[model samples]
Target chain A: MTERAVCVIGTGLIGGSLMRTAGKAGRTVWGTSDSPDTAEEARADGFDVTTDTDAALRRAAEDDALVVLAVPLPALPGVLRRVDAVAPTCRLTDTVSVKVAVADHVARYAPSARFVGGHPMAGTAESGWAAGQAGLFTGAAWVVAADDGLDLDVWADVAELAWACGARVVPAAADEHDLAVARVSHLPHLLAAVLAAVGAAGEDDLPLALAASSFADGTRVAGTRPELVLAMCEGNRDALLGAVDDALGRLGAMRGALASTGGLAATVNAGYAGRQRWAAARDPEAVRVRRSRLALPALREVGRRGDAVVGWTE
Target chain B: MTERAVCVIGTGLIGGSLMRTAGKAGRTVWGTSDSPDTAEEARADGFDVTTDTDAALRRAAEDDALVVLAVPLPALPGVLRRVDAVAPTCRLTDTVSVKVAVADHVARYAPSARFVGGHPMAGTAESGWAAGQAGLFTGAAWVVAADDGLDLDVWADVAELAWACGARVVPAAADEHDLAVARVSHLPHLLAAVLAAVGAAGEDDLPLALAASSFADGTRVAGTRPELVLAMCEGNRDALLGAVDDALGRLGAMRGALASTGGLAATVNAGYAGRQRWAAARDPEAVRVRRSRLALPALREVGRRGDAVVGWTE
Candidate 1:
């Protein structure tokens, strides 16, 4: 593996995870954090940590290093300004959840730096300097967005970093990355929050106590850092909105099917069909294999019990 | 602890969990299954198990034991019919997910038997004879529904079983139980199944492979027994439909908020407010303490920064 110096700014979950992985991969890794305590903690944990943003940026500027902006979305503009002031010639990348806004901000403020908007679709609810794990991005998807003007070699280096962290690489436009995440990630978070709220509603401890695994799983993301979720939602508002709308439309149809007096069997069948259709559309091959292995047998068993108690029409 | 004999019919997850807990609590537990292998397995696991429903029912009839119908909803009618013929005098109860349907069936088919409908809102995705755990119902909620004409002692016994198994007891009408489960349990299952279906539709392997804890948690129940879910949906169509509708309406509103020019800040604010409201409604004491905790400076660091950005509104 070709050796590359990597400067990870922010020293948060994403930044810390990357540092740990890169250091393990034998890459020269340096990190910076605003909090001196966090910087000291990272250093104690074996990361070459620093508190000076300019010093970190200057190091990247002096070497052929990859500079990753792993800060929160709201903090991006300020961080980008600092990067531009100190490391105008360094190759830049980011691990922001929402890409379009940050891409726009970079284009406006730090146009001189060779930039690629990226998002590693992986994380836990835990955050900050101490929560970083070496394998956090293992088997995760790394969304990379680059324009035609960027050097192919620089793109490959960033892509290599993603691969080193055990992430599969996917090429997406900044807008597409933002939109897809809004649907797959952000909307789910909001839905979980809403569901949690619903479960928590009323003085009925029975319902809350009765909340089983489904409740726990459904609301897991709702319990995440409320501010961070809020920022992601705010940053990728249009896309998240579209996703929420699409989800609502689908949910409404399901509700309507259930409400109809045409029998519960039919409604369940419709739900099953809709789910199958959506899954097929999202990933046909995996769905085909999984449906065969797990879901098909169960469906067949239900079918064999009796002839078409409920069926779906295209 | 009283040493009363309890017959658990259909030795699957729910039934086996009950038997394990009852046995540990000093109850003489007897179990029956249609398959001789399962019966033998349950018996080998220390319960007095039998394949012959008649023999089990006769034994319960002779002993005046509590007969728990822990079979699928569709199988309930057939089981009730058999129990009617063999154990007509035994105190009857059930662990069905949907109560209204079972209650109605019992009322019509075995009107003479002292019957109560029950649902223990606790389980794992794993099922069958092997998946039963003694602590399965621990810290969970048990819903009990009985008519005024039934024996109070039997009701107390069932409630005691729930407590002995480490579950909190909650009383509701059969209809109420069905409605509440529809909202808190059934709808979430549908959502998970749908979301899984959506992820399964992705063309690339990355999304499915990269599906982290959030995706796994969100879709856990969707990966459950399709037959069981279909049965629950069919059995509690009206209530599930109503809950799905409520969820859809809320999702739509969220989507609309996101799509608006102001974007996600408003939607997030609403979600935060909704969660707070829900928490307050469900457990005022917990919510009060949470609010107080949120007010503390140490916790404020982790509190949502977006609320300030979104600002307070009506």
Candidate 2:
């Protein structure tokens, strides 16, 4: 049996890392980059990277390769249009931060493509092909769309690719994935932004001067590039807005409690318990099933139960 | 002249670390712990530790030691009372998280002591003497009181001790220090708690399962002991309330902009700029002065300019 091929479009951190990871797993992986400099650098690093997207899509279609859209949200439509023109029935997925938007773009621009949206929850704040490396996805949760009536074969292909990259496959609906990430990832970014701004507004630089590990940890992601943060927080506007509302409600309650009772035992205790819950679920129980008998709803249920797909026996 | 003797009350993480640090710096240091287990452990670790608070205070007064109160806010009053009874005129300071409250406690209990409030802005989530180590204050900021009419000699003693412990002295008034920490330290704890709670409330454990570095970083401090968090935050109620109001205002604005304009460029950009400012001031310019020539207002102005005291060349 031949290892499935992977065609990645984009050579940023996520895309480039996927390309390296897939190739290292002996998959026939190649990538395309819009930036000539990025393509040259990846090629110089001995990866098959090109500036031509249509040719890559054509080859991917001919070879029945998985076409992973690795571009930012703003670049999605153009790449999807090329996929439509060159490989309308290709096995398609994406590495975008948000999932539902990618699914919508594929429906509009490449409706015939077999799309299984994916997002590998891994990255540093760095960008470009140079920052890409193998094992970037090791131990990370890779979300794959588990919406109803999806192509199980293509979903399997995407999930297997994630597995080969050393990631645990978390089957979730596109909308659910977006909301979950908004709560965990995007909301943290927004909160970090607000905390950093408030801490910086202190008179006499005293706050920053006395800032310790807690302040540093809380604002770590606020140091991420502004454009990238904007793309993430803004791309999932509805979900993030909801998450923000939840956070604001919590903060408002905390403020009220602090102001009225001069105490926040309830908030602090709840947070402590929440943190304990996260710690307890850090290494979730592994769920295994045969790929031949894999049911989408059942797999989604495993994810819902805080279990990760660690194996799919043949 | 020989190094001034040091006496520490409350042998917890901060206190235990100070005992080791001062001993290593060639000062005659001793500490008392209310917890017999903690005192026994510290004594076994080759330091002079006892469970007798009054005896330690009496010796400190006899030896003209700089008495350091390293107790939590709740234990502060009882320890301060001992200082009043046994060493009312001794050189006094503290390592409490909140300065204003400790100052108030000192005024109400041990008013005649030559007191100069101090707080080392360094610690871990772990508590107790077993978690303590030498050099804990290395490269950290140790804030010393610079309120009007402070005993400059005792202030110099506290500042010199911080220097010996490998920390830069940040001269700030008690009220100013409380307000500043309310922004940097206490407020982050609250935000982390709120964030942890919000993230944990996600449906189906999806958010926790998909939590990544950003979520982990933002909620890192939420794992701290709730009692410790409560003490620090509640101890500085007025200042923390003001800080919480500021944060809530920013979060509210972020939610409004994200909901209406579907854009948070302003928030993200401002946060990025704030993070940049923090990075710039990380290794502040060094301010050196002779101990004799150091004026209280001038030293505080140095701190206001984000400069750290690195030397006191005679």
Candidate 3:
């Protein structure tokens, strides 16, 4: 079967990369950027990019192209409103960092759109069309929302797009994705911020000057642009709260142990074991059942077992 | 004047590296390792190494060599006892990670030794003599203690050795050095451990597989051996407690803002600014005042201002 056409709205890092990847994979791909400069850059790079979202969505609706919302969280509502106005029933998914918030926005603004939330767990600490690369998603996990009562056809379409972009699909509920990212991504960002701030609190430059590999690695993400960090951390506030609480609980116990015993054997050993497990974990074997054998429950079970959807047979 | 002879009491990563660095700089250098395997490896590499601490100390006393106690915190007292038995009045310093604890150990066990605390803020996670490299301390800060009443003659001897090994000397008080490292080094290790454990708590590979640069960088140091981490964190308990308290306070506030207002602007912004400051900082200009113009207070003031001692004039 010929690949479905792709319509990407917002040709910055994620969107521009996806457009390039899909086009390179032989799909009919076009994208729109709110920044005319970015659109021009993408077009100059031989991509079909424009500054008109309306035209992009209308073309997607007419050609049955997959519409990918690639805007940041703060820009999601406006883009969804445009999707509602131009292609309310278009096959849609997004590349936003937070899922449940985007799902809620889709339900409110583009109610009839066949939307499945997605977040490609890949990126560099860079922005703009210039930073986008065709191979960015290769070997990365692309999470696809598998919330119950969803259309499997649209779900498969999204997963196919991810696979076409050289990604493996991990099926998860929107809420679960938010929670997982909160633990792995969002909480790390916040902790990095705190760590960086504390390191600098000395105001003497001694600590900063003395900082070595550990300090650099721990605060690496804290160097990300504040606005981007704010959007992700705030957008997933509910889930991040839970993660923060968990970290705080662990830290509190660690502090108590240190104060009393002067030994961090427990915290250090647990963390050491955790790191070892992370090193030991190879990806679970990929799964490919027939389309008839797959459902939301099976997909979720595969995700819980840490397996990725590699393909589906007839 | 010719360079003084050097003797290192540990031949693990730091000690072995220092021995190589000193020997390459034309200093007469030899070392001892508790591990026979490590000592054999060092000896096979054409360096003078042994497992006999008593013999090493006796040789140092006879040659008046600058004796570097490069053992871990737990091994400091045992090594110092050997120094007391064979070389109680020898010129002494150490490369232990913690400053105050080592100072206390030296005072109690080798009181007559002209002692100065030292810690070269450099290393890799890998240990053992084979992992040591000659350029390990090149351009790194080798902190030499400037505590009150410290014999400037012995302090100068230690600083001269650090400079001879290609490191710039940062003179700081033992307590001050402890506090500084607690913020930049030890604290970061603990936080990395917590972050790693929290991330792995999911008991599913999804978070680990989905983890990208942020997670990897944040938890990088947690992959170090737990015993090493415990030694550093537990050895610097009082200062680490203060640093951890500061981190927890900031985290609590961040959580409050996230829970109540759903905005991490304060934490994220402070962190961004902190990271910006770190990026903007250049190594401070080196100072080389005359020996007559330098004292413990003056050296510490230079350290507080983040300056390094590149040399000293007659």
Question: DockQ, per-model, please?
Answer: 0.20, 0.88, 0.74
The complex in candidate 2 yields a DockQ of 0.88
Which number leads on DockQ? 2
Candidate 2: true contacts recovered, fraction: 0.85
- Indicate which candidate wins on lDDT: 2
Q: Over the stretch A171-268, how does candidate 3's per-residue lDDT look in tens digits?
A: 88888888889988998898888888998898577777778888888888888888888888899989899889999999999999999977788898
Better of 2 and 3 by lDDT: 2
Misplaced by over 4 Å in model 1 are: A35-51, A146-149, A166-176, A262-314, B40-47, B146-149, B202-206, B265-314
Quick one: best TM-score, which candidate? 2
Cα miss at A229, model 1 (Å)?
A: 1.2
Candidate 2 root-mean-square deviation in Å: 1.1
Native interface contact recovery, all models: 0.31, 0.85, 0.75
TM-score, cand. 1: 0.81
Which is superior by DockQ, 1 or 2?
2
Question: TM-score of A-chain in each prediction?
Answer: 0.84, 0.98, 0.97
The single-chain TM-score for chain B of candidate 1 is 0.84
Better of 1 and 3 by TM-score: 3
Task: List pairs with backbone clashes in candidate 2.
Answer: none
Candidate 2, which segments miss by more than 4 Å at Cα? none
Model 2 over residues B1-314: C-alpha lDDT tens digits? 33899999988889999999999998999999887888888889999998998999899989999999998898888888888899999999899999889888889998999999999999998988888889799999999888888898898899889988999988888888898899899999989998899889966888899999999999999999999999889999999999999998998888888878888999999888888888888987888888777688987887787778876776
Tell me the lDDT of model 3 at A260: 90
